[model samples]
Target: MRVMVASLAAVLLASPALAADPVQGRWITEEKDAVITIAPCGAKLCGRLSKFLVAPPQGIDQRDVNNKDASKRSRKLLGMPVLTGFVENGDEWRGTIYDPKSGKTYRSILQRKGSNQLTVKGCLGPFCQTQTWRKAG
Candidate 1:
């Protein structure tokens, strides 16, 4: 009885950790426009822009001049933190996402669509937009 009870307690305690899938790696957007890399940040998971497959065309304005420090920055938007504090929910993840293009952050959710595909959703209340991402090679 003692061994059985101990084993049950151990399993219960480790359940959370065991349920979490390792999502640390690089993912690319379906359009091949952006790449995101996920890694551990403290006890939570965070993701940042790792690469840009194509640069904004010349004469195209891509700066958000509305943010507090927007005027102090350049047009470069690479390496920005797009996802943060995402907690795993089965095969999906929920958290906050920052969009450099709009200089805004929104509630976000990410799901593994398949072995090499991911779907990311950013929402504000009922309005939501989803984007597909592929595992980076």
Candidate 2:
């Protein structure tokens, strides 16, 4: 009886640690255009731009800019943080996403849709857009 009780206690204690840190890896957007690697940043999680499968899509223009600074034109946004301040919530994580193209930040949430898929949503009040991301090898 004592051995059974101790074994059960150990299992219960280990469950949370085994829950899996879903965001602890690299994820690629469904478009397969870019990949972001997420890892522990202090006590929170942060995502850094890992790769650009190709040049930024044509016809896409920068949104917020003074249009006068020469240095801005030379900025390399490939390794910028697209996700930050994310806290684990069950199978999902909630945080803020910065869009370097627009120079804007939005409230974002990421939820695991599968073993290797995540649904990312960025919103301003009631308006929102969702994109699917897959775990990258």
Candidate 3:
């Protein structure tokens, strides 16, 4: 049983449990446009556009026509991952955020403020735009 116990301990130390991160949940965007669900994808954390609270110009079932890649243009917007490669950085998260409207991806910094608020920063060079997202009910 000693070897079995050692193996179990090693496995636990290797992979982080998803539930340990408080950011793993649904959040309302700063604009209240859509609900984003932040969850574990592969070995990292990713945030996806899960639900639309407001309809866009093309409606809820719209395709990703604004994507830079022609092949990905036909993909649907809902359930699309806007935040990818997010990993724990001290108390915050560092990741890449994709903007469907601009067809661009930016360096993103996610810092949780208080219990219900999260500050998301999308950076370009030294300039960054910040937005506050609230935990969804």
Best by TM-score: 3
Per-residue lDDT of 13-114 in model 2, one digit per residue for the tens? 878752434766899876787788988899999898778875675422322242245556454556767799999876578899877656667899888776
Best by lDDT: 3
RMSD of each: 4.2, 5.0, 7.1
Q: What TM-score, computed on C-alpha atoms, does each candidate reach?
A: 0.71, 0.70, 0.83
* lDDT comparing candidate 2 with the true structure: 0.76
* Candidate 3 residue-wise lDDT at 12: 93
What's the lDDT for residue 108 in model 3? 94
Q: Write the per-residue lDDT of candidate 1 for residues 1-137, one digit (tens) a residue.
A: 99999999999997865344466789997679878998878888899877777765532344434344756346445665779999887667888988765677899988876678778899999999998888999
Q: Give the alpha carbon lDDT tens digit for every residue of 1-137 in model 3.
A: 99999999999999865532357889999999999999999989999999999998899888889899999998999999999999887778999999998889999988888789988899999999999999999
Order of candidates by lDDT, top first?
3, 1, 2
Superposed model 1: Cα runs more than 4 Å off: 1-20, 57-76
List the lowest-lDDT window of 10 residues for candidate 1: 58-67
Give me the displacement of residue 21 in model 3, in angstroms. 6.5
**Which residue pairs clash within candidate 2?**
none
On the 0 to 100 scale, the lDDT of residue 67 in model 3 is 90
Pairs with steric clashes in candidate 1: none
